[model samples]
Target: MRIRATVVAAVSGALALSALAAPAAQASDDAVSRADIAKVREAAHAASSSKAAFSARAAAYDEPYALNVTFSNFKIAKAVKVGTTNRVTAKVTYTLTHGTDVDITAFDFLTDPFLYKGSFAAPQNVLIGDDFGHCKSTSATKATCSGTIDIRPRDYELLNADAGTWKAGAWAIAFNGEDPGADDFDMGKVGYAEKGGLATTLVQRYSKLTVNASPEPVKKGKTITVTGKLTRANWEAFRYAGYTNQSVKLQFRKKNSNTYTTIKTVKTNSTGNLKTTVKASVDGYYRYNFEGTTTTPAVKAAGDFVDVK
Candidate 1:
């Protein structure tokens, strides 16, 4: 919807892993941004042996020396379900392990967490926070950090393709004394660290279900037809579409009962429509239920009341 989620925003508190927001290149994706920043780092090095202009892209670039740092306890919600035209935000947390020499307390020091699908070296799709993770020192070299991953799906965007398992990774940068937006920057003095595939998470498309039963008041020996449809969020078209071939359960609850019992299991037709017949035995309510899969969440339709004579 809005520019792809990869064009990350600078974090707040002057400590957001996004602290660097200067001269940002609105590239198509992160790989391009990385290459551009690497090139800039090179040119800046040649122009001035020790200093270079500030660039956000440097976090992904490998430098001659890296600070002694590692990440642990990386955690994100196991499931991120999103629908078309709505905003979803995932909270992220991790432990930053660094050498005593590294001062994560300094505002210039920043860190961030991200998610990607496919190879980490060159992810097919990425989700990054616009803000940096806020940190609190837990020990001399250990700090607890937290941030958010924001996704707003709207309009035709190549998002449906991103559904499924996504891996988590992160990067950190210490500006040292140089500001990311300043003209006089020293890349040689900045500290950088990055790691991929630290953890795994699942993202799924939102789902919806509905049900209806005919002959609200029927003779006890008569037959009644129950029907329903299964649909899921369509991020590309920003509308709901049928989810075909899914197994759905037809459930019933007596008029005075508190629980529903599955009566039969039926598969969605070509268009995700469900139809089945059951004998009218007593007054009760009927509904359709779908047990979710990896790419879709489970859903249950509201019960349709049936009054049997």
Candidate 2:
């Protein structure tokens, strides 16, 4: 009934200037007032409500039921050799609340076409469904189910073709099938559905990844240098490319300290290597790891300790 998520707000401010002493035309005297602006805003909200009413009606017939899917421990297996099937498992689970025994399915599609090996190619579709017929609310508090769904290379191709490629990782799973209509139940209250479900398309989505370190043994007031090396491994089967020249950060933490410090930002080499240096005035051993941006993974490396000499 109530969803709590961020709703972006757009703000527009308009400024009007009037000159010519006493407006040559009567229209000049009719400047919009704050109260008038409020009225317009009220009217806009009303119009929005009216449009929403229509959407609700359409959704009534189209999305008769609403099923929310979630995931836990969602993971993609390490990349496999090219031309091979790269698989990721959802450890998926779900709960059906108030639906007319509907068969539900979920998947991923690509938003654009991609070129691979000198040829235009498409991605595969990952399908999620249950053969169990129409589900109804249990007199019991909750219902449950659990299983691991695997994604194949062909599935990636279909997803790429459909443009649902952005649905990668544990975060991109989607739901398909008619909304079950109007029943309400707690999905996690039960053991099976507790972990949640994931979209199958999230298995393969990595490219241009590397790890780095800094200040081998940083002492107080000394500058530390950090560096990263590119593995240069293409996860093509997983819809990922191997490229260097990536930008990354070096994260540092003083030994026995509760928080980590950001040392410097740098970019990887054409071969996928990044290096940077920073000064540390504190006296203690420091831990280091490669910082990640939206596209890269956060990786921690072995820590080296340095004493103030």
Candidate 3:
């Protein structure tokens, strides 16, 4: 049955860039994002004092940690709701401060924020922007940067278990114009920095609700039937399925009244369908409201206006 789409509320310092970012022209998107952070961390800790620098293998590393840099003032929405087929994007912003000697605006230098589902040092999964962050220096030693957090429920990057709370993280790389993808490079030329768990937010299933009141020209005091269905995005099946056995409120407003009063509370059936009957009183509107749960955001159906003759 057709229903109203649940309104998605996401807040950030700024909205993410529109249009899905295509793979970067300089390098393969996956080659840089999928393994860059982990590989950087690997080289930072794995390298011994004896080695001149880690080679292309990215094994046995020793790159000086970017102790001079730090991140703060991060802003993200309290919740991120995703549907089965649509791509969800949220703007992420953070403040970056570094020593004066660092040229953060250099073309190849990279600093961006991301989200992770597990341990920061060894995360089970990570989500980064399809494009790199855009940083404009605010001062000699500070800059404000913004980037997009692109989410596609259908991608391999997303697993059903990844739906709960996710931790905020930021990382930086001072490639110094060195080719990180080169067969062999001097790791000493590169610098890295990262921090995790700066903040937390929920990633929830998108919800949809629909309501309809019938017997449009009903006589006063006659029976008026109300019907609706409650459903939430199912990542596993890539569809919206019935959200059964959930409490939903049937609300009514007099034709001239601005407020909606609760007429009755009903539970969705096995198929996420809701049905009930009420005596027609005056001309007004009918709607259904779901308060929502931890895994889904609250939603309200558009009021269906009915005329009582």
Candidate 4:
């Protein structure tokens, strides 16, 4: 998630003053003085400088705090269809062993596609936790967190440009003592831990199927020609295109029946066109069903009614 400039400035200003004060012996004593607010302008300037430096060197810096934090039991949906709503969840169990007594205050789970190349863009914020929901400590050194990430249609827009595997990781901010003041915080106090072997792939496609049976109301035992076409989203052209050489099923449902039975299976031609013939027997509905591929979602066309004479 992208942080708003104003929010970042506010947080940076608060943390900068905290950086100037002496380390509190106890978390309860970590209060800020009025003098600290007086230096707000100075703190803000310093914060901007620090941000600039961090951005310039962030790619090369391997966050040290990650070494002390570990994540496990991570899980998420293996696949999601394009243009659909989906939810992803993960269980994060972390141990803060860097210090004998570390107090965590805030944290968030993030997913970044490998395409980011260490850039700030493309990292989707998953779940955020404070002393509230989705995060709880079992012991001074151990904590467990779990939460669901709702993916909406707008969120899928992120994949409109790129699609592939993405990695999940945790970013946490911890204080040395409970109730620590602002000055007690620093970039060094944050941690980022990525779990290996936990990745999800995204495919950029959707499918469409259609069907029609000709010679309606024909004599019984007469041949009925069924034709249809299959198409899928073309990411490059931003349009739907024929999906050739794919297997599709021709199904029929009697007028009074709710279930559809497969009449025959046929493969698409070079232009994704479907052509088949079946003997007219009774009043029924005909449709085409595409089972779908790894890159596309399954689809069934609306039933076309056929009258029997």
Candidate 5:
């Protein structure tokens, strides 16, 4: 099945702030007093506490600044076959209207797969461009970024195990003041924007099937044996492994006819092996059809012909 959906996140209003600039003091020739050193230590502790509080607020989605950022042209793969080395690339264009003279330092784009209870697991952050150069500003107000993240077998397994929808979105961190570690810089002056409505898609996997019918020519009343195996992708090992205890349909197509009819339903054994018997009556073809589960896609094996004399 093919899925196409887009979710948009819009930002309204501008972020504004005002603060007083610290006056530079002249150098003193005398040694500093112990009381002055204690005051400096107290001020440093206060700054650390403020930074922690700001981080807590951002985590809770209560950031005070309303970033004037817009995201567009975000794209992601609809589905990926299960594999440890599999990866998905997400691309997006963004416009930052932070008035004039505001430079964006860094940003992150993330994907969060929702759980069965309709909440999100920990988000996976994508790597943006080469050394984060893709986000370089084309102008003062706009920039385009593209990045890819590995989708490990564990990610697919989680989606398959949970059988739910997954969401991809963007989060941005913009710095307006000096570098973070500077004594004159304040963490509260930073801008944080998180926009979660981008794209939603399902995670699906592929299954493998094989079938064979022995004794090409048999007597009219002879018992014919049909054998097959059912297996699926083993993402961790990057190989196909047996899928046991799954129901599959045995089908037959008479020669010179355009249709295949279900003969009987059979289940795979512990080794994903199948063995069934049918009476030879006419010249026809035999095959296996898998209806598939939520995590796997439906598949049908090529027909094997048998002739009755």
Candidate 6:
């Protein structure tokens, strides 16, 4: 059986290169100028620090935590229904201290809903893998590429936990590492706190993942089975094949519809296929689209579009 993807809805910012950033001491409390913000944004774009990677014996670290994570281009391509699942995407970047205990392991950047039963000193976030939530590669590392986390529609619950109120722009992200040994670095801790130097009060904005949906102009209102293919064009090999969760929701928007309505949703089979089918409801000049998001090898667009008749 195929499972639905989790839907993520949040607000966050990303890197944008401009000539407004001025070098200031890390310890200084001066106001951040537009130029400084642009420089930081440029660095975030250059490093691609948010994507996932694989590492065998990379550096490790401990103690005074250090991670600088920035997420931009936040959007919700296809929002999840009351019962089905969906995906969300965002750009991420970060910097951390390297050491022996700081085993820079690999991880899947997918996001999922987690339950915390531990106290503040020892909080525990567990991903409920029932749906297409929080699925990624186990061999991901920092040496490969920046990581992207895919959160399901229900994963927002995990981000909202441990807080008293749910603010409009406040959110949290947890990274689950690929290491399992006692001496290895903790994936969950590294992802949330150690891996990306972000404030405990983090925020993410919503962006759109456009899926082209169009019907054959000649064969208006045709009932053909439409198949769409999604692939990572600008990602490393390990990061590309490591993302086990490729499920997607196929949707359609009529000539003048304002919102995307979900027509069908499907989970990728074991062979890495995020395939789904839907019947055409509109005639000529219709739009066919798919809405999805993830962290591992973040996919920008839903491949290409097709014409139906």
Instruction: Please give, for residues 1-309, the per-residue lDDT of candidate 4 as tens digits.
Output: 222222233433322222222122121223433223224323333434555533223422222233245555555555444443332222333332323334444322221111121112223212221111145667776666554332333332333333344444433333222222355444343333333333443443667888889888777799999999998765445566788999999999999999999988999999889999999999999999998766676899999989988
- State the lDDT at 119 in candidate 3: 62
Q: Estimate, for each residue in 219-293, the C-alpha lDDT of model 3 and write its tens digit.
A: 999999999999988877888999989999999999889999998999999999999999998999999999988
Ranking according to TM-score, highest score first: 1, 3, 4, 5, 2, 6
Model 2: per-residue Cα lDDT over 1-309, one tens digit each: 101001111121110000100112211123322222222223323333446432222333222112232333333322212222444334434333323322222121001010111101111222221111121234342333333333344332222233222222211111232111225322111111111122222232333333433444455677766555634223334434433555455565665786666665566667665666657665444333444333344455454455443
C-alpha TM-scores of all predictions: 0.80, 0.39, 0.80, 0.56, 0.55, 0.28
Tell me the spans in candidate 6 whose CA falls farther than 4 Å from its real position. 1-215, 218-221, 232-243, 284-294, 297-309
- Candidate 4: the clashing residue pairs are 18-183, 19-183
Residue pairs in collision within model 5: none
> How many clashes (backbone atoms < 3 Å, residues ≥3 apart in a chain or on different chains) does model 2 have?
37
Which model, 2 or 3, shows the larger lDDT? Answer: 3
Clashes of 5: 0
* Candidate 2 lDDT score relative to the true structure: 0.31
What residue runs in model 5 are displaced by over 4 Å at the alpha carbon?
A: 1-66, 70-78, 84-118, 121-165, 173-190, 197-199
TM-score of candidate 5 relative to the true fold: 0.55
When superposed on Cα atoms, how far off is each prediction in RMSD?
Answer: 7.4, 20.9, 8.3, 10.6, 13.5, 19.5
Query: Which prediction has more favorable TM-score, 2 or 6?
Result: 2
lDDT scores in order: 0.71, 0.31, 0.71, 0.49, 0.50, 0.30
